[model samples]
Target: MTGLLPDNDLLVQFSQLFQQRTSLSNMQAHWQQYHWKETIKLGFSNHKHEDWKYTSLDRLLQYRFNYAQKLKISKQQCDCLALPLDSHRLVFLNGRFIASLSDNIYESYQVSSLVEQKNIPVAVHAEVFLHLTESLAQESLLIRLAAGKKSNKPLYLLHISSGQTDNQNKNIINSSYYRHHLLIEENAKIQVIEHFVSLNNQSHFTCARLTISLGDNAQLTHYKLAFENQHSYHFSHNDLILGNHAYAHSDSFLLGANLTRHHTSAQLNGKGSYISINSLLLPFREEICDSRTYLEHNKGHCHSQQLHKTIVYNNGKAVFDGILKVAPHAVRTDGKITNNNLLLSKQAEVNTKPRLEIYTDDVKCSHGATVGYIDIEQVSYLRSRGISKTKAKQMIIFAFAAELTESLKNKIIHQQVVTRITKRLKRIDI
Candidate 1:
């Protein structure tokens, strides 16, 4: 596999399919020969690549890469960041599911493996993204949620990555690249809380794709918290489809990793559908964070909103790109997006871009972006109140983060997110 990217296994096999060298009828045969169960390969970058151009992951893979095989986890260990959730718990160690570390029972949802299902059709609307992962990922994890079910309890997902490498006696060390495929059925309502944390100081990378399909009148609430070591890299892609009158809300908190990128896409395919996305990222110590969001109004009477806040300090960098596209026939569509960045140091950097593409004249669409440092007047007023400069700065940072965290519908998850924000604020030397 020298000269062939370790992350290119799926793409390599997919190349054969695209070239007609391998037939769909013979896919099982190829799967047996070139199939990697849990490990994956990344692609080489060219000028034509749209996604990786800004992220620049091509240079990072050349470094010694290590993949984590199945690792053990104890319930008592790494308890400081844990959140109390009553729903099913799914735990992963180095991108592999660790059954011993997960809670098997749940009152609201049933969890099963993708391999266990005999037949499952790929949704037509999600075909493009599915093809991307199928050509890139080595293995996939599937989550199937039943219809018309509502959960007050939150589904907890804990992802633990350790910097262990599988030598495999090869010149290049084995590093695990992870991908996941999530599907929520029609008319289902649920709350999912995902936490990604690094166990040891090992450089690693993660790429994930999630697709959700909402039935008429369905609803969903999603909360994500990511904390990685300063040496690791992270990439994630989210795709959501809304049915007629369906609703979904997503709130995210990002705190760690040297480099992290998030790509989110939501499509309003049915009339009267709605979605709201709120996110906050706090970066320090030279860490870099970037996020791109796409909201498409394919049907009339659909609405969407996006709001993102970022805080950068100590030479760290943050990037935000928000795009809203209204189709020709999607009249009366309403969409608004805003991206705001708060710079805390003279050396810190931020890039904000908000774009709107409208094909319909009757639609209401607006977008805005801003990047600025804290107001000196506000700081002086706080200092005059007998508060030290450091404490005042910390208070201002905490208040900025609380804006996004306050939207969490679940009380317990809201508190957990606040705790993470507080920890990030305390890490700042200012």
Candidate 2:
């Protein structure tokens, strides 16, 4: 196996497995014949590849990986993953949906085992989506929302994996990877919350694929939070497509795991579409957090804004790379993006990049990034008020993360995020 390209063995095995399972034989053959060899032929990692420079997947490959085996989840366990909202909840254990643990809803929405579906919407049937799909293990656990319907309550999707239950935990690194697909139709107002949790302190890998389509006047909000154990690794890919007059907002909170990488790519194809993205990432002591986003305006009169904040404590490290692209025909498009970091200790590290690529002269776009320490004035003021130095520092750190937490829109979720942040702060040494 080449040292440059990570996961060479898995890549080869997945290609063979994908070709045998997929009905799209032509595409599968194309990947197996060309893409597979090209990817694995590389002896060393193209670390300089701008997109991969920040988060080093190759370095992760050097360690042993424990591939989690598929497991069955009982109906009782599915109930625990149900959301507070009027959502259709489904549980996937070890990457396979458990029918016994799911509700059968065929009229309003199609809720069942994801393995039942053989095809996805055109919005998600793209080149990049296909490549990742082929490499990921297990058929995706799917969720399809009907058109023109508004969900009374938000949707909650819990991808729960108990390594002990799978018995594959004894593998070298014990990494588990998951692949799933979701689709939302037109005129639907849906809020989706995804939670990643583990029961043991084993090294794991989780990879998820999400495809969301917003029809005319549709509204959607997606919130993804990661709370994995110390030795786990997570890689997630999300794709969103928006129609005319549609709106979508994304909120993410990454607080756990030794290494976590989240990638989001959105394309605005319709006029009058709008999107806002907000994320809060806090990494502490040996934790590595890497996030990347790509937003494209393919048509005119589209707008997007992104704000990401990172707080690093102890020897933690973080990376943020954001790109906003406006196509040549996308006149009157507007976009603004910012990535900022608050470093709590000298040992903390941060890397931020906000990039803009515009091909249309009629568009307005801006991008920037900032990295710095806590505000001395705020700390000093709290210290003068009889608070201890350590306590004062904690207060300031929480305040910095408040901006991201307050954007949750849901009061309950906002409060939960705050509570989780506070808990992490308490666990760390000031």
Model number with the top lDDT? 2
- After superposition, which runs of candidate 1 have C-alpha atoms over 4 Å from their true positions? 1-43, 46-54, 58-62, 78-81, 115-139, 165-174
Q: Positional deviation of 124 in candidate 1, in angstroms? A: 10
lDDT of each: 0.69, 0.71
Q: lDDT per residue, candidate 1, 254-286, as tens digits?
A: 778878877777888889999998788877877
Clashing residue pairs in candidate 2 are 4-43, 4-44, 4-45, 66-174, 66-175, 86-153, 176-205
Model 1 lDDT-worst window of ten:
32-41
| Count of clashes in candidate 1 | 9
* C-alpha lDDT of residue 233 in model 1: 71
Q: For candidate 2, lDDT tens digit of each residue in 210-260?
A: 767678788988898787776777777677888898999998888887888
